[model samples]
Target: MGWLAAGADHEVRLDAGRVVARNRQGRVLRSVPKAVRETEAYLELRQLHEWLVRHETACREQVEQWLVRSLPVPTALIVEVWADEAWRAPLRDLVVMPVDDAGRWDTDRAGLLRDADVDKGLGVVDLDGETGRLTSTQIVLPHPVRLPDLTDLREFATDLGVKQGTRQLFREVWTRPDDADARRRELTRYAAAHYRELRHLQARATAAGYRVQGGTATVKIWEDGVPVVASVWIGEGDPAWETETGPLGFTDPAGGPVRPDDVGPVAWSEGMRMAAALHAGRVIAEDEESA
Candidate 1:
């Protein structure tokens, strides 16, 4: 914003989301003068900064929602929002795959998002650090569990010093064991986590962006055109009372149990991720003795 006369001696303008002042001699001050801070220009800039902060947060949450659901976003939609800093910030450097007309993931062609141009398509940097563009009509930011060569990808990301605005490559994932009794083992794996209070467990789930209803912390995943819900029961009794978390389980849209062996990889990993997050905190109640 252009500098505006603040007082007889000072002129102020919005600079890099901050209201900065310059003396009459045209030297930038280290900080806004005490008197200038109360000026209308400074107040306006502060309000703008607050709005931008909210905008950035909202954009990031939307992008995270897309990643969790593994949605195939339209390329045009990406291009439309690519210009906005709030939207671009969360999208930049996220590993993306082009989706063919038949909706199959071009797994062999994954790249870190870098730019979007209407005529040139989405520009990206691939695993080999080669700059390229994918002209596919749609693309997906796959969940880590769905990604191939994840170990190598993490190494490559680290080598490049890449830091994603949203968790993707670095997101923790769980691989459901494949065995004769995998179902039972998976069910018991993260179960019976003792919490000092039922409310504490519930609070953790909610704070981690999962929905808690009917004593369960829940997240839904859409895999292979089917919806699966994963939930961990925290308990329904008195909120203040101590409790133990129940087994993490998955169910179909119709509410039928989905055995761990039958659960899709993305769903299994995300479910376990949510379960682990809620199970992480444990405290011994004063009434109980340590093992």
Candidate 2:
């Protein structure tokens, strides 16, 4: 009863009346199928992935439990730490994955373990459905992982910046068609405004001699192709902004500028600016009494 955990270039094959699996590195892993259903090959791969995740979870939970009992700290302190984690940690990172299913391991099922602050690691696992003989290989132990305590100001600040930046950028760059509902239309307009502003800022900054990195530019258009400035990206040395530059036909090695196809809803402030400019040309009638 052997099993294999393999990857993209590797697969389990029924060879010589036995299951033999190879990884991308040409290494063979020992594995046995827990269940085999005749289905599309893709579905089979998915099933194996599911099994791998389950085994990895079981093993990681066991490790955490062992840590609680084995640590030399007082039981009260351990309990407090556990309670704190239970309440605060979103526990999202606890979900398992297959980082390098290609690596050969002597186990029935295998995957990867990833946590917020630690490097992802390989997991080797085994399972027995009938008598519940679930086991794991205790080889290549992973580095210790610690989840961020939300109260940590530094981590909180970093998270805040990422969320705010992503939300603002996404809304500004991608827009919806007129057939979209009011909610969708509003979102497109918001994104358009953001794009236009970013472009304007990038141009101004670059012209002033600051290097703008990963910038985007956007313009709004009517369904019939009338152009208006919708939004723009303005910053120095931010690589993540690269994705939002698509509104321009091509991203500038130095920056991006919006074109007619990028149009969406205009911000009220933008409209007001146009009105102000228009009024600037008008002459006011003089009051006879004051004259």
Give all candidates' CA lDDT scores. 0.87, 0.31
Residue 170, model 1, lDDT: 97
Residue 85, model 2: lDDT of: 33
Q: What is the lDDT of residue 99 in candidate 2?
A: 20
Query: How do all models score by TM-score?
Result: 0.82, 0.17
lDDT per residue (tens digit) for residues 1-291 in model 1: 688888788998877867789999999999888998887767877798789889988999889878877878999999999999899989999999999888899988899999999999999999899999999999999888878889989998999999999999999988877784875777767777898788889889999989999888899888866899999988988998988888889999788998777888888889989888876776655664553
Candidate 1: give the clashing pairs. Answer: none
Best by TM-score: 1
Expressed as tens digits, the lDDT of each residue in 130-152 for candidate 2 is: 11111222222211121112223
User: What TM value does model 1 have?
Assistant: 0.82
**Ten-residue stretch with the least lDDT total in model 1:** 282-291
Candidate 2: Cα lDDT at 289: 30
lDDT of 2: 0.31
- The reply for model 1, stretches above 4 Å from the true place, is 1-50, 284-291
